[model samples]
Target: MPKLTTPISDEEIRSLKAGDTVYLNGIIVTGRDAAHKFMIEHFIKKPVQPDEQELYDDLKELLDGGVIYHCGPVVKTHDDGSYSFVAAGPTTSIREEVYQADVIRHFNLKGVIGKGGMGGNTLKACAEQPAVYLHAIGGAASYIAQSVKEVLGVYKLEFGVPEAMWVIRVEDFPVVVTMDSHGTSLHDTIQAQSKEVLVGLIS
Candidate 1:
């Protein structure tokens, strides 16, 4: 399997095709619903406010040529004020479809990790921005958390743990390319094929 590490380039991202199994190694940030909306409204749709500027800079540095995981991890805080992921399962990605394309474009993201899949807008962003949608296994929260090697930091704890953006370093993190930069989406393909089978059965 191809191993994707930090500083991943657009060429590297575009080289991946749907159904390819890959291992990711590097810094990734986890973001869910609240994080996404906050990013869009506070960072994308409007100019960054003075209070939010630091966060915007941090996220911009991390996300450019980096990956974002659609995860709301169960975390364990150490007595020393550190954190670790107990369960890092991916959340459903479709909920962020409206904001995802913009995020990818604005952040220069190379990949998106989540369970299930996204929609046309995300697919278009993948093609145009030269990014990919990586599918992490669902119901394997504990197993997935094992790949999280370290918790670098976090943002927006006010949104609560689940919705907060958790910065982490991962090693050999496994995922499948369900949506590639070439406009191929396994989710769309499967749905179309399933529809064909259903029509055949009913006819």
Candidate 2:
């Protein structure tokens, strides 16, 4: 399997193909519905006014060139108060379809990881921005957690543990590219082909 790391370059993303198995390393930020909504409403939708350099800088530092994981992990706190991921399976990605494109453009994100597939808008954004969508295996939460090496930090805990944005460091995190920067999507192809097959059978 090919390996990728955080701050992934545009060239590397372009080289990826749909159905490629990739082992990801380095940092990734976890975000689900609430986090996506918050980011879009506050950081992306709001115009960067003259006095808001700090706001822009903060978002850029956290998201630029990073991979956004559509995950709400189960974490455990140790005696020393450090956190560990007990289970970290991917959430369904289509839930964020409305906000994903803008988030990708605003953050200059390199990749997204989730289960199931996204819609046309996300496919367009990935193509235009040179990003890729990696699919993590569903129902394999505990297995996935083994790849997470460290809990760097977290944000927006007010949304509770499940929805909070968790910044984590992972090593050889496994995923498959279902959508690529070349405007190809394995999910889309499969769906269309399946429909055609059904039509032929019924006809």
Candidate 3:
């Protein structure tokens, strides 16, 4: 199992092949539908507004050679204004397909974590941007939360806890490289195989 740390280089990302089991040890941001849309609109499609500059700068730095998780985690807020993960399962990734390719290219992201793999645009971005899409196990929220070592900060709490962009530090965060920079997509392979089997049965 390859273990990768944050600020992973494009070279490091390219070394990974589809079906590789990997563990991540560093910072990752949680972003779901609202967060993805907001990022595209505020940071990618248009000029960064004055008030959004800080968050934009922070995200730019963090996402540079970094990873984003398609997750809406359950979290607990402490009295000291800190937070912790209660459940950290990955959400379906396809919903972000509209914006994910651009996000990867714009932010220089090396990896994306989620379940239910993404579409062709994301696969192309992964190949062009030298990024990979990692698949986390679904229905294992509580189990996955155990890998979340700390909550560093969050943005857009107004989007609600799940849709908020939560910065988290993780250790031994397990995932599989379902899509690779070399243009291999496990999801596509599976779908093709399934379709062939269905056609064979019907014929």
All candidates in order of lDDT, best leading: 1, 3, 2
For residues 1-203, write the lDDT of model 1, one tens digit per residue.
78999769988997899999999999999998999999999999999999989999999999999999999999999999999999998999999999999999999999999989999999999999999999999978998899999999999999999999999999999999999999999999999999999999999
In candidate 2, stretches whose alpha carbon ends up further than 4 angstroms from where it belongs are 47-56, 201-203
Off by over 4 Å in 3: none
- Candidate 1 collision pairs: none
> Looking at candidate 2, what is the lDDT of residue 30?
94
The candidate maximizing lDDT is: 1
Of 1 and 2, the candidate ranking higher by TM-score? 1
Estimate, for each residue in 26-129, the C-alpha lDDT of model 3 and write its tens digit.
Answer: 99999989999999988899999999899999999999999999999899999998999999999999999999999999999999999999999999999999
The ten-residue window of minimal lDDT in model 1 covers 6-15
Candidate 2 global TM-score: 0.93
Q: After superposition, how far is residue 139 of candidate 3 from its true place, in Å?
A: 1.3
Q: Give the range of the ten consecutive residues with the poorest summed lDDT in model 2.
A: 50-59
TM-score of each: 0.98, 0.93, 0.98
